[model samples]
Target: MFAVAAAAGQTVRNAAQRQLTQTLGTVGATHVRFLFGFPFAVVFLALVVAWTGTPPPRPPAGFWPWVASGALTQIVATALMLAAMGERSFLVVIAYTKTEPVQVALFGLVVLGDAVTLPMAAAILVATAGVVLMSLRPGQTASRPGETAGGGARPMLLGLGSAALFALSAVGYRGAIISLPTDFVTAASTTLCVALAIQSVLLSGWLALRDPPVLIAVLRAWRPSLLAGFMGALASQLWFLAFALTAAANVRTVALVEVLFAQGVSRFAFGQRSTARELLGIALIVAGVVLLLWVH
Candidate 1:
């Protein structure tokens, strides 16, 4: 039940982020989400400590390195995902995110020496092929508004880069958890809160130096940004809890349902039309994820 709620929250968060994308550029929008979200997370963590009557545990000697790596990767992933919002289809971005499970599995096999069954390998190949096929500009289908063949390359690249970073982050977090204590939820949450703060500050500083106009736009749209941040913080809290309770694969696989949830949001909330090709891509992604889970 908690997992389902977390999944739903994530979908809502994505919708909020999509709204932010229109008013602010991707990086700028993400910066606002994190900047506003950091304080909420800090308070949430503090509340958890108070309620539990325990101080957050100190992580093991090497946990900081893993936590740092995870944080950096997650920050990059967030930026890339926000950038991808302007691309061909939100469906495309979702499809690419679905690809992350396969990538993480591959990384696990290589880096962590995790076992990969033949069925899982086949599924990975099939899923990769499907993503490539879907990514190709359609020759037969008529182009939709704000979409054209090959126009979404930049966003696609950004999305894939985000997925890669997410995979790295997953691995790092897994390592950190193993090295840390079992009751380290507080520590994990606190670490992530700090990491998000750092990422937001760095992104804000850079944007301020390089693109002050975007920052100005963000300020003007502060209300929406703050709301988005609240949603993001809530979603992140659930995700962190899920990560602490389950393996990354299980959590991410369940989270992939966010794509379907996004589809609903696009249709109803955003009043956007989704094409058959996009629907087909969604099915393919779900199938791939199912296959990945079989191996797990």
Candidate 2:
């Protein structure tokens, strides 16, 4: 349930951030998620603390590294994703990012020592292939086998890089959350608060020093940016809760449903229709998701 909510919220957040990107650029738009979201994160943490009647746990020596990695990598990943949006169709960009589940499986194994069963691995592969198929354009392979359909290698590379970084971020956040010796809600909320603080500070400082006007623009567009921030924070909180309960691979694999949500948005909101290949890809993704749930 948390995963479902997170996926839905993330779909909305992505749309809001994408719109902001046109005016603020990638870095500024990325900053909006962290900077504007920090207050909401704080409120969430406070609510958890108030309800539980316990303070946030003090991090051990190892916690900072994991949380820091999560924070930093997520910022970069979001920037890369927003940058990719500028170069490709929204659906194509999202399809490329759906590769995160496969990458997350590998990263989770290496970083958090999470085990992947054969069925889970197969599901990841199937879903990844589906996303790759969706990324291709009609007659793309026949005309230019080496290059991507609409754009060249750059957009593809950007999307793949974003996927990889997001995978790492997920593993890192899960590692951080599980390391805490507290209840899941408290631990997840605390980790979220700290991660958002780190991201907000780092991005805010960078923007202040490098691109002041973008910061101003973010302030000017505060209404939509605030909504985007709230949605982003809500999604992150739910994601952390899901991570606390399950493997990052499982969480991310299920989160592929976000692609379907993105497709819906593309079609109805943007009047972009899915091709036959894309529809086939969506079917494969659904099959993979169903198999994954059944196996689990």
Candidate 3:
């Protein structure tokens, strides 16, 4: 249930992000989203603490380092994802980002000594195959300027890179959660708010010095940006709660449903027409994910 809620939150956040793609370049949009979201994050943490009659746990000496590292990775990942959204179809980008689960599992097994079952390995292969099918591009010349080469390769690369960094963040956060005495969800979520605050302060200071015009635009565009920020922060809280309850592998595999969510967004929001092949690809991906979960 938590997993489902997390996925829904993420899907909504993606939709919100998709709307931001055209107005701000990927980096600018992310900057706005994070910047606007920072204050709400603090409010959210306070609300959670107040409602629960609990305070956020004091971090251990090493906890801040882990949280900062995790946050940095996420910042990079979000920036990369924004770049991908600017250059590619929403459906394609979502499909590619789903690769995070497989990447995270590998990272866990290889780096963190988490065991990987054969079934999990098979599931990873199945998911990879789905990604391959989805990424196939028809004949397009690379020499043509402004033409998308190999369909969505460049965007896919950016998306994949983002996914990888996001996976790293996930693992790092999971490890860091052990240092806190409060609810892991609260701890993780609070860490996110703190990290975002750091990012917002640093970026705001940089922008104030370097580019006042864009900063002014962000100030003027506070209405929508605030909505986006609130949603983004709320989504992060939900995701942190879910992560606290479930394994990252489970959470991520279920989150792959974002591809279906993306499909809906594409069909309705952008009038993106899908071919028979795409529909089939979606079905296969869904089935494979279901099988993977069932096996576990």
Which has the greatest lDDT?
A: 2
TM-score of each: 0.75, 0.89, 0.82
lDDT-superior candidate, 1 or 2: 2
Number of backbone collisions per candidate, in order? 0, 0, 0
Question: For each candidate, what is the lDDT?
Answer: 0.69, 0.87, 0.71
In candidate 3 the C-alpha lDDT for residue 197 amounts to 81
Residue-by-residue lDDT tens digits, candidate 3, 124-144: 556556654665545544433
Stretches > 4 Å off in candidate 1: 1-3, 78-97, 112-137, 140-159, 182-184, 216-220, 270-296
RMSD of each: 4.6, 2.8, 3.5
lDDT of 2 at 150: 60
User: Over the stretch 1-296, how does candidate 1's per-residue lDDT look in tens digits?
Assistant: 33456678767776677778877867777777678788888888898888777776666778788778877888778767766765545556655665676777766667655566777666665555555445554553314555455445566577778888898787777666556665656755676586677677777788899999998888788788777777778777777776666555555655665666767777898799878776775676568657765665
On residues 179-268, what C-alpha lDDT tens digit does candidate 2 reach at each position? 998999999999999999998889888888988898889888888899899999999999999999999999998887787888999999
- Model 3, position 93: C-alpha lDDT score: 63
**Candidate 3 to truth, TM:** 0.82
> What's the distance in Å from true for residue 70, model 3?
1.3
Task: Specify the highest-TM-score model's number.
Answer: 2
Query: Candidate 2 — which residues are off by over 4 angstroms?
Result: 81-95, 140-155
Ranking by lDDT: 2, 3, 1
